[model samples]
Target chain A: MSDTLLRLIRHGQEQGCRPHQRYLLDRAQWATLVAALADMPEVALLGLWGDPGQVHAALLIEDGLLIASCGVPDGRFAAFSPVRPGAVLFERMIRDLWGFVAEGGTDQRPWLDHGRWPVTGPLAANPAPNGMAPPQPVFLPVEGEGVHQIPVGPVHAGIIEPGHFRFHVQGETVVRLEARLGYLHKGQIGLMLGKPAPVAARFAARLSGDSTVAHGWAFAQGVEAALGITPSPRALALRALMAELERLHNHLNDWGFLCNDASFAWLHARAGALREAVLRAANTAFGHRLMMDRVVPGGVSDDLRPGGDAAIRAALAMVAAELPALEAVYDSHASLQDRMVGTGVITPALAMLFAAGGVVGRASGRGFDARRRPGYAPYAPAEAAVLTAGDVDARARIRLAEMHRSVALAKGLLESLPPGELLVPLPQRGGEGLGLVEGFRGECLHWVALDDEGLVRAVFPRDPSWLHWPLLEAAIEGNIVADFPLINKSVNASYSGVDL
Target chain B: MQGWRRLLWPRLAQGLVSAPLTDPPPVPPEEVVQALVARLEAAAQTRLGRSLAIRQVDAGSCNGCELEINAMQNVVHDLERFGLRFVASPRHADVLLVTGPLTRNMREALLRTAECMPEPKWVVAAGDCAVDGGSFKDSYAVEGGIDAALPVDLLIPGCPPTPTQLLEGMLALIEAQRAGG
Candidate 1:
């Protein structure tokens, strides 16, 4: 929180289906941004989210953070300017998608999208899919001693999401790294406009399949706020339980991947098995292994039917029994330790600049977790504890720490199962609302607006992945290409979630 | 053909997997069978209650629907018990659950997925994105809703619709067959 002061800065109405006309900073004002950052000691972040196709930028100063994002007429966005050199890319995305010009951004070439798209941006009001093919990617040449540029993905050897990685190497030491994503951009937010909230919430959950609970909860919170509905206390606790379950499950998987990446097969297999067991518990408690349809606005869709608890408890108990052994492997495995210890190191300063959160930030020594900070619902002040270190090892450790924390939360909820309605009815008169859910990733924000007809005016799932993706790109420096997987998994930001 | 092999092999092989505790006779076609009727509607075929084999396409979905879709195939609700299973390839699929709106990047892929599904294929736009491009409508690389690119059989709305609803939608597709698709 250095010069960044964290404050409860109230945000203005988040309009949908349209945005505020424009935010034109005069030359003096543009220069004043650097001055403003220096002047405000309590600014948490200089947040900027831009609509890749729109001409206007959504500029707001919250606490000391200067946020700059672009907006479509619908008030949603294509990409956000997360950190330095973002404006250049934002401008380029705008140019490629909307044919708009960013007044001052220098690098105006295509970023995630190619411009041969005869139609306007992907989410443009009118588009013809049959318009034209996209342009080919241009590879930037590497011209320095020992600085050979090697391009990696857009497609990988394994079954995973798509992304392109360019590494500048000095005989295996990565000097500079570049990542290009958007292969997964499925315009979900724009499609939500005009749809009923329940119908839209399901799409939100898929923003990242891995963080289904968090995304669903965040979207539900926004709709609930719009209708002024609070879930029954029992329902609230259930939501919290499910969220924590998801967190635990995800952490376990990451640990497994981290171990496997380090060639620690025993730990990987054990962790994967444990994760599989946890998912089984999830299926027994909620009807699905991933618990997808369970968390909705007001409350969950399913309750613990008879025999649900015992089965889940059995799985939880087994996981608890295995923790000590799991920790032993984590502590004793030399190769895993070597690969994870100091690789992909994000110093405390850079993590803050990039607004890294969740285990990624926690591992690096930055101590902000929405569950502890903003204090929402069942996770309010009482049960919110965060561990911060700011390193790859610290991140892995924090993930482990969070799993234990999740188990504790689950136990607390089950012991005092509240009896009442699961979900509350949404109020008829809908308005603007925002929800902040502490997902496995971090703060998953859903900014929503409802028309008089109860249709979604606009929905922006400001997933934590957006903030963490840049952090991954930064972390890849000074490491070999092979170590990338473990380091990348350390901050496993979801591409589909953020691209939308 | 594999279809006949898949059909005959299961019933032919049932005795090998079944124990005395789990042997139940298949109902005769003449018995009360609206569920079967629904199947005819679901697949545009005369036979009702045929096991539904679905092929799922990401086509740029956010992955919410994929999770629920995956959940439906798991043990809890056990969609498989209700005669539903997901096939890895589209050649065997009767229903296509498409997520995400058609992105410029994924338009060809999305159309290719739809084309790959055999005739009488039904497309269920699982999330808002597939239904109408969800929240990412106007960006440069996206093409709007999935239906704009393919003929849709049903619109199961949600940011990502719940598993129950998705199950219901698949069931509805079967029912549609009886009702005359």
Candidate 2:
């Protein structure tokens, strides 16, 4: 946390391109590095990169975008998870994918490679690092009489993504909840390695279908940063427009699902109708409902069709007009109020510890919006709405408030639309850069390291879900079993985003 | 309270008395019904019935297909109008609408879901990933497509086929069933 350590590790930006810094550390320095990062106020991410023969441990300090990395001689390194609970899952992932040993880590459970994989530690030198079959996952033991465990799905009755949840309950109250994800892991990072930035952008887009535009924008920004290509003003505005539309539609969808969970069918129906309208508008304007693969490294794939702005304006007006009526319905619905209010509370301390992003963080009194922090174009002057109730109602209200702001922002951006080229050609060069975008869910971060031929040597697109998913475990405690659906809908963390 | 009542009554009334919720069918209803009737008559020759029950298995999708599938049940598409419904259990299903490339972790679950269906059931691969693994074909964790694990009867191609496209695929499968091939 010291300025001296930050100066020692921080690499100066040269010629507008951020270079990846490497600090070759002896065993003593490695220990010092881990201790320094763990003492920081917030550790955004801690991960292991498996280069040809060496393993590098990288930690991203939340403030100033300081990334400190140390290369270890072998795969074994001192773990930071003992001091930082947020790094527990990351360390487990490091063990599962890279076969690296997080010495003295808290937990040893496998993260992504769940033994169903043909080979263990696919990113490591040896396919099967342990030279044996993966051990059966041991669920933490729950003591005390009359406590029972209920295991819910990798596949649920509803049409959703796959993830397993095990709840330890006493009578109707949930004592503890453990979530097991990664059923959707498709080796996305491995697939991105060695591919051109444009090609890898597709994998980033599909990381989570609903947040395609956000992830795609983040990936494009990272690639552009690495290549030192500044997108035209028109492209930046268009990207922001698309991001707000994405946020609007996704928030509407979540609101509908939340209403449905609360047994308010009428409001759910209305929300769904409005959401469909938004998607239709997007299709007319951007040529895809979810806008997949529309955002490339240099710029967007296409510009708004002629009069496309009019269609978006019409849709925005309709949504704005209808939202108040829907909000009235939601306010009048007594059953929904009873179910959502004062349920699934996350304390401010927990939110800060987990570095919760987006609505989850804002609702919990942690005002960390990437748009305002990194202050990128089109949103640099904009303010993100934040609230502090830390309950299901707060989460819902946060989304509602955001939807209103996004409508206003979108209209303003469209009215004052910039004129110029949508893309700038990128020179075939290689460097490393970081991109941070305020996605629908929260801040989506992508770090890219490119080779001399402009091929991606290493890429990590960290979804906000990494911070939010673990918080769900803490939020569900002490709540009754019946409130699980409402609580889960409130968080609505992305499984695919984290699984990848 | 008075203000909310003022706003809610008109919208509720409008919703209740609106015209048909969906846009008019792209194809003439009579012609489509005639074709469907013919297919149903031909399908009667086999053990399969005119109505189809579908159970969707998300092998490893990005949830894009699932969202589209959900859209089909909304007021716009109303897939149930075509005598096709998504059931909760595969035991009651006549068609398996599988999405995504089969991930290693989901392969057994997909197979088990398929096996639960009764005889004369067909599998419809609903996305590009289901057909040939799409962009994630070479992933170490994926088995490529549904064809690698289950017998696919029809392939509906798109990153995710639109709701109407999914409905069309279902109707085509009905025709394929009636053709007795």
Candidate 3:
């Protein structure tokens, strides 16, 4: 254990969690941990979620991942949001779902419960009927001359997921942009409980539809870890292959849309074609375009079909061939550059402060890819692309770099493909485990606690969007109103993932 | 002078001659397109050449359906060429293409959108969730299906219907509307 875990354990007892250490803290210890968060800027708060009787916080120290759990005996606990800004929304979500109040919390507003759920705190020990009329959402007031507010969506103009954005602006210049999400919440965590791990993995795949493969693999890894099962080498390589293909398709889609938002229709067209090709190849290889539900507990559900490797390589080659010309157009286009460069800048300090992951963090000079740390099998340690600018252009550049790397990685996995059994049977025993993977957007973390019968007792799927969404609010602080869409596309935070 | 010359000449010439990458609709057979086109044309004859204008509503989807729906606009799918285009507001729409299981938080928004659409509007439920809360039926937040909240005219079912299936559904929707009227 590291010094941080040792300090955390002094006030609590460590639980028998596989692959990671989880400590159960009392109220006093919880309060101490909350207080220490202010002084420990080096520690990143990975995830914060709650169950009926207790709350758990996943923390990343210099050495490894540590989970700190605190009992909510009185339905209240010390809030970490006062010191950790990233904990504010997580604390709110805990309140809305498990009915636990974060004592001395900075924000008291409801997060996912827009006051319209059938029951209040549906995951609470005793959920009650919610008959109260929903209240109008409130945004933080911005006071300045000529300042006005512009509210967009739970329904947007284009075909997209639903979420609200409140912009405070002064003569076309944005002062602050706050996102109001949770329109897609469907009790994901509540639905996963009590089901078998394989059955529950379906919900994980849908946490964010675009990240189905990554989320599925992460959830599967957690279950396998709990059972102390290692899948066949072929299964591990197949999972990586699916994940890389998913990354390719999604990044191509986003890159196209980013350019389209900048009014560069030509690049959008080319990128869209390439994305379609990638999706087609993925469908041929995995029998599903998005590869949903193909990855389950213990191992992957299917092996690669004959010529699957060739299909994937052909798609990759097409993309590779088009890259030089596509990049030249993007680099030379003055209008696109004007819209992207210096717009929606999330400073390196702010990125570090929030512990932002994925492209958003990497673009801001924080290099943290979950695949490289606490990593699983069939993957070589890879260097994440880091850019210091932290602007929309830097993010776009990062996506381009990641796509190239994904191509290489996918090909490498194909060459080293091994032959073996596809899955290992999971033991029917109780355990707790954590799974972390690098999805297209960033790190996707999932935690699962299984009962004696191998049924899911509690599960939390933490999307990387949780960290990037707040960074987006800060990124759009000073940008012009007209540039909001372009800025938003660059971040492209998932509403459904964060809503759950 | 040199910068301006380099910027405009080579790139402009290269862009002009780039062959189109769009392929014809790969599914739903050409006959379906012709039949739908014939129906649309007949309908247009009666309604001053108005094609189908749709407004998409994401009641509470996982966004997988939305991606396929968006792909309809891409070159390969090219749904707009079939005379169906997505509009910004429900008031301007002839159909409400709804996806996802109807969540309690979004039930009112979905209703308001359907109500705002001009009279003689059709509601097409796309995806397994919107048709009947596919994998999320037991959850407390979901209404199970769009039919629970609104009258669904057509149901296109899959975890998320492919772009080609979505187009076929749209065609069937228009044909159904014509025959029913």
Candidate 4:
């Protein structure tokens, strides 16, 4: 019944956790919260990560976000994965990173550690030497008559990031699909430690390259919130502008790729052209095609160049003019529709259980956009499309609807652009802050804790892909082997984003 | 009838282009191609004349370089027009466009991919990370760069090089191949 759920834990409120509070909980309190999470459907786990001698969980309860942390001085802690199935991967990662054992945790196989690292528990207080040879990963067993296995990737047959997918199939139908990721684990969070917020932001920006602007903005937002520094109005608007542009280009590319995987190359080519135009506009406006490191802690790094608005407008106009025809073609193509309409159906129950966000969630009848709830500045709450089909077609349709909204949002922000300084000096102080931004894929969450010397003590950047990768496995059930590529493209979960 | 009209409208709306949308090949492929052809003519003594086939590998990038690499296949860059194509398997590839800082998990896979390529192979490290680890340098999980795993013939620099820069890298690889001869 408490809006701040941490109040129910009877723990001391941490100081300087801006916009929201993080409570330090005792063992009993931590156990109670983890136990209660299973019964509470409204509370969603935004992130679960390990800090040296403590573990933290970010939860969304009754429209408010709060963090609950429990100290594990002896390297033992009660596991949430027993009650919350979504916490399983995080539990494994915590074990891999901090050498912490989660008592009664489910599926404790190593997540990020493949046994080839130079050191074990790289983020632990005292890292151990890793000398053992990497062993073959154990996948979940599937037993059925005529059930054979198909193994794919780590090095896929396309120009994309790497992650292995194991599929169990009976003839043509996929019985179970398991994804083994972590090929892109570069120890990003460990590298962020001891660096200032501005320097650490580079890691966040690279957390997921496709959502660079959104991730960069989320990182900047966390730093600003931690230091209690509000960026200038112009800086906020520019950040939003670049974020929407990013959303537009990525959406365009996805729409095309979904079709491309379905054997429709025409739409892919057209969509690719439109995406190129958007990238060119971003380069002209923000100095880089992907706009990496453009959003700094205090504000954006660069102002829009002269005539930047015009370039943005031109790109939007071309997209707007061309989209109707593209949509019509997609809609009218019976062959494409046949492949997409009923394929990769993720039921609303699974969507709700996983707290899936972004297009996938919206397509399956959940309309929780971070931009609208616990909202931030320089913009008003806008409409998010919700369709109930829960199929590949519904996902594609959601992308189309979101693309139109992004173009309009980018234009609106540019027209009302504020004029002022681009950045403010970040103060040297310690604090904790969380940032949740709606990226093209979904809500990207970044939680940061700074030391007294203003260096990063610990941070976790949770890409929406973290929550969706498991769902992809669920979505592939019953679909034929050949349709896996089409279904996978429809979901488009980022491999590198979650691997970190 | 409506479906047919919807599909045909775009083609009717815009006629064939007077010029290709992509910029001209960064360097004339002829001189380099001839050099390669001449060398191959001496070494293998087989009739060899065709476009360059590249196989792209993501060692551990943030996926920015992959996006630009994907864009190179788009209508604007149209990398195929420049006598370069991205094949699915390394066995069919003449060059390897490898990206990322070469994470420990990927180091073995990348080497295996390169080893799968036949003789007369070339490797181009296609981003700053692949060049020398970029921002991901000094991370315990990374080998620092692709060179740690395989011999790199060229390095394309940029956090993630733009498609134009990537195309230039391809051209430069061809020139390097010719110069090696």
Instruction: Give the runs in model 4 whose Cα sits over 4 Å from its true position.
Output: A1-6, A10-12, B1-13, B16-20, B28-50, B175-181
In terms of lDDT, the poorest run of 10 residues in model 3 chain A is A1-10
Point to the candidate with the largest TM-score: 4
Off by over 4 Å in 2: A1-8, A11-27, A37-63, A126-135, B1-18, B26-50, B174-181
Candidate 2 per-residue lDDT, tens place, B1-181, comes to: 9977987899799988888667444332344445544654555635465579998888889888888888777766777777888898889989899988888878877888888888767788989998999999998899998999987767789987877778877876565454443
Please give the lDDT score at residue B8 for candidate 4. 76
Q: Report residue A201 deviation for candidate 1 (angstroms).
A: 1.0
Top-down DockQ ranking: 4, 3, 2, 1
Model 1 chain B worst lDDT window (10 residues): B22-31
Determine which window of 10 residues in candidate 2 chain A has minimal summed lDDT.
Answer: A11-20
- Tens-place lDDT per residue, model 4, A70-123, is 999999889988777778888898999999988889888999999989899999
DockQ each: 0.19, 0.64, 0.74, 0.84
- TM-score (chain A only) for the predictions, listed in order: 0.85, 0.94, 0.98, 0.98
List of clashing residue pairs for candidate 4: none
Clashes of 4: 0
TM-score of each: 0.71, 0.92, 0.94, 0.95
What is candidate 3's lDDT per residue for A156-251, written digit by digit as tens? Answer: 899999988999999989998889988999999998999999999999999999999999998998888888888999999999999999998899
Q: Provide the overall lDDT of each model, using Cα atoms, as 2-decimal numbers.
A: 0.65, 0.80, 0.87, 0.87
Best by DockQ: 4
